[model samples]
Target: MAHRIAVAGATGQVGREIIKTLAEREFPAADVSALASGRAVGGSISFGERNLSVGAVERHDWASTDLVFLAPGTTGPVTLARKAVAAGCVVIDVTGMSDPDAPVVVPEVNPGALAANPRIVASPVAGAILLSLVLHPLQALGGLVRIVATSLQPVSGAGKDAMDELFSQTRGVFVNDTATPEQFTKPIAFNLIPHVGGFGEGGLTDEEEAIAEDTSRLLGGVAVAATCVRVPVFIGQSLSVHASFDRPIDEAEAREAIRGAPGLTLLDRRDDGGYVTPLETVGEDPVFVSRLRVDPTGPNGIALWCAGDNLRKGGALNAVQIAEELARRGALRG
Candidate 1:
């Protein structure tokens, strides 16, 4: 049965991508509503042949919606989600902390988590999903015990404004214009900032803490230590992950596991700059993995690199996949 769906934050990059993904995957949505702030209510967005008029959540009828895709800037979706759920709509939250009781899901990694809880599912940050998609595959080979990850994140994660900042700054720098640091704490063009989210205790940024927490939760409680950096790139996210397993693992065994996993594409090559990079992975679905080797610094350490589109796989695509998972199991209710 086709469900009636509402996509909140419909004007943002990830929200727009969610609509695109839903249409591309042929999700069984009998009607799709695009939702945004009140100012966007009369605005319109294209969804295939239909031009969906953006509706203000303040006035939208939650009772008529079957599923709600919550991709609003972190805080915007909280109230709408509660109301949507109360109105009997299952919600797939993209970047918010949904009801604490709601399962944060990566469908490929943990579909069963939602089998019983159909009302709400939260999508972890793209960084967490990217890391889990690549690292979780090795669970069968003695399982992951600990992970140390350094994420080279793109400006897109910060939002559309950050992306604009990067572009305008880069252009400003080239034409002998001053690249101002406005949206970011520092100029993002032609530079790398080793800070994302606010700083937390123990010298870890909030983004790092989140990656650790979400990775552990998604990967069945494996400890994660993350250092998140904001790079100048416009799209895609890359992680250099050093994983320690409970048992000995060699390059061949690790490569085999990474290459064969779902939602991951092995792109490791030995020579001539053969490896996955953010530029090559933006707009792609599968997490492109490369640079697999046994870490020489420590025992039982397996190191690898991974990249995926921050907008798609990291945000919209993951959200869409969660919806698809719920629909496949007939968990979506109007």
Candidate 2:
């Protein structure tokens, strides 16, 4: 049975990727509707040869759609999500709208969490998604007692505007001109920002807090300390994870566990150029892990670095996987 699909925020990076992924995966859909702001309406986007004219979400009819992929952006699906769910449509949110009441999910780490939720599911942010994928496998070995993570997130995680900011800033610098900060608080070209979100009470940015919260949520309550930073790169997100377990885990044991974990690609070597980087992870699906070693600081510690495509597994791809999970469980009755 073919289901009618809707991709909201269609003109944005994640939204465009969702539509591309749908076609690449050869998804069985009765039809796909691209919805966005008024500015993007009537502009056609190509999905595997089919030209789809963008529909202004405000004026478009949601009655014909059965499932909605809410892409990442400020225009969160809050108002629209309510309207869609009220109409009996399943919604997979790509944006980081915590929605305290809604279930936060990373299919590989917590598909079960999403199964019980009705109408809408919130996907974790790029840092959380990439971090959780690596941590979940370690859980089966013993149990994660403590997790300390540092993320090197690219501008792509901020959407198309941030990417443009980085590009324009870099070009301006080369020509002896400086691009003003428009989308970001600081100039992103040739610079790394330690802050990804606004500072809160404990000096923790919302992005940092979100990483800790989302990781714990997916790991079933394991404590996590996260530090998120924005790098100057255009794509890919990387993380340096320090995991402490109940029992001791040697380098061999840690490597074996991660190597066998599904949706994760292990590539650890010692000599120069042994680990993974954001540049190598672009357009890739699996979370690439490298720099595996035992942290001497903790009683039972394992430290490693991992990277993955933020636009794919981090955002659009995860949402698509959730949609697939919903179908497998008959959650999308429509």
Candidate 3:
């Protein structure tokens, strides 16, 4: 039987990607609805050959929906997810608003966690998504002890408004026009912003905290430290991850392990600089890992660079993948 699906925040970047991915994957959807805030109402979005008119989410009856993909910014997703699930819809939330009670899932890492709650599945953050794919192979070989990562995040990580700001600022700089900074506190045209989100206690930005916590949760490991930064890039998110394990690790063995892992592409070529970059992986679905160097700092430490499309693997694609898995398993409303 085909499932009836509704996409919340359907006009946003991640939301649109979810719709595109659903169509690309040919999910069994008998009915599909696109929902957005009042401001985006009347706007039209194309889904394959059909054009879906944007409807106000507040005015929709979500109870009839079988599954709802909530891709709104941080604030809206959680509330809408709760409502959708309470109305008998399975909710897949791409936003980072996770409850301690809910499973923070990276499907490649833990598909079993989805079985615990039929109501909601919380997608991990971009950094967590990249790290989980990289660490999965390592974790299979040996237990992971610690991980240190630094993210070179793009403007799109902040949201669509941030991307707009960067584009306008870059154009202004090119034409010698005065540009104003609004989406970000600092100019993002020619410069990088060390800060990504609001700062919390102990001087960690919210993005960093989310990355660190979600990485640990997704990997099922307690020891992980992450330092996230927002760079000048536009689409992809890159991470330099250094992981320490309990046993000895060989480089060739590590490469073999990564090659066998699902949803990961190993681009490690030790001969004269053959590594993956953010530009190379901007639109790619799989996590790209290269520059695999055996860390001399610890007994079984390995350092690798990882990159993936933040909009796809990090947010939208992951959510759609989870939905597909659920559908395949007859977990979505039947």
Candidate 4:
């Protein structure tokens, strides 16, 4: 049941990770095409033990491709996605440019949503994925009421250039050189920016809005308030989450729930350095949960710290997992 697959935006950070994840997981792909813009067409990207010569995505023939992973930075991704769908190829959109009504899926949380064999499925933002993974298990203990989260996102979430800016700025600071902000609005080295995306109505950034919207959708009908911040770190994302449920659930009960949940690891030890950090979660799949405590402010509230590799579980790995879900459901076309 090998299927033909194409990964658009094959050169970007998340795009490359998608290809790598497909290979690492040994997806049943009869053909895998690496595609990017014209500038990256001739470049070579590794796929398993082979190197794939990149192709221009705009000129690719999608009629024969059974599936496409639409990563960010693909020029006219919205148009490209429609074209792919028209060609009868299922599209897994990671670009956030899909139809507003498209099903946003995190396989670990709401995989049943894929039973319909949808033409287009959106991979939720990394922050939302992280938030949802941790909160979903607890929802089974009691219905979720409200969620308050502040995310410390790494620069890699922005793109490769943002990572470069962080590195160069840190180097410049030690060499007595001024580090001007390029990928960011402010110097990211030794500093933090409370801004992650464009400010929208009521002063909430687009990132915050997306996280709240996606989390609520994923968790059924819970209220979510998010404040996304750009930190000086490199790879993983961290969150301080406070969640209230309909029933009073103790920290021990919540810990047991997280431990048994798939795609989640409970690492609470109540001692310094006993829990996972952003740096330690790099290149990992499961979301790491730590600092679990019962929030005293509310009757049925719990507080915790969570970290994960945004590129993997948050983006590429999640998209690849959706493709896997499709395969398992016999939804993918040959």
Instruction: Name the candidate, 3 or 4, with the larger lDDT value.
Output: 4
Which scores better on lDDT, 1 or 4?
Answer: 4
lDDT accuracy of residue 211 in candidate 3:
88
By lDDT, the best candidate is 4
Which 10 consecutive positions of candidate 1 have the poorest summed lDDT? Answer: 72-81
217-296, model 4: which lDDT tens digit per residue?
Answer: 89997999999999999999999999999999987889999999999998888778889999999999999999999999
Best model number under TM-score = 4
Steric collisions counted per model: 0, 0, 0, 0
Worst 10-residue lDDT window, candidate 3: 72-81
Which residue pairs come into collision in candidate 1?
none
> For model 2, where is the 10-residue window of minimal lDDT?
93-102
C-alpha lDDT of residue 279 in model 4: 98
Report how far residue 232 has shifted in candidate 3, in Å: 1.1
lDDT against the true structure, each candidate: 0.86, 0.86, 0.85, 0.94
| Model 1 TM-score (2 dp) | 0.97
For residues 38-89, write the lDDT of model 2, one tens digit per residue. 5788898888889899988887578888998889752557888888888889
Give TM per candidate: 0.97, 0.96, 0.96, 0.99
lDDT string for model 3 (1-334, tens) is 7999988888888888888888888889988898988678899888878989988888779878999888855336666777787889898877767345567888888888878656888888888999988898888888999998998899887778998888998999979988788988889898977888889989888888888888888888658877777777889999998999989898888989999999999887777768887878776899998998789987899999999999889988899889888887788775
User: What shift in Å separates residue 235 of candidate 3 from its native position after superposition?
Assistant: 0.5
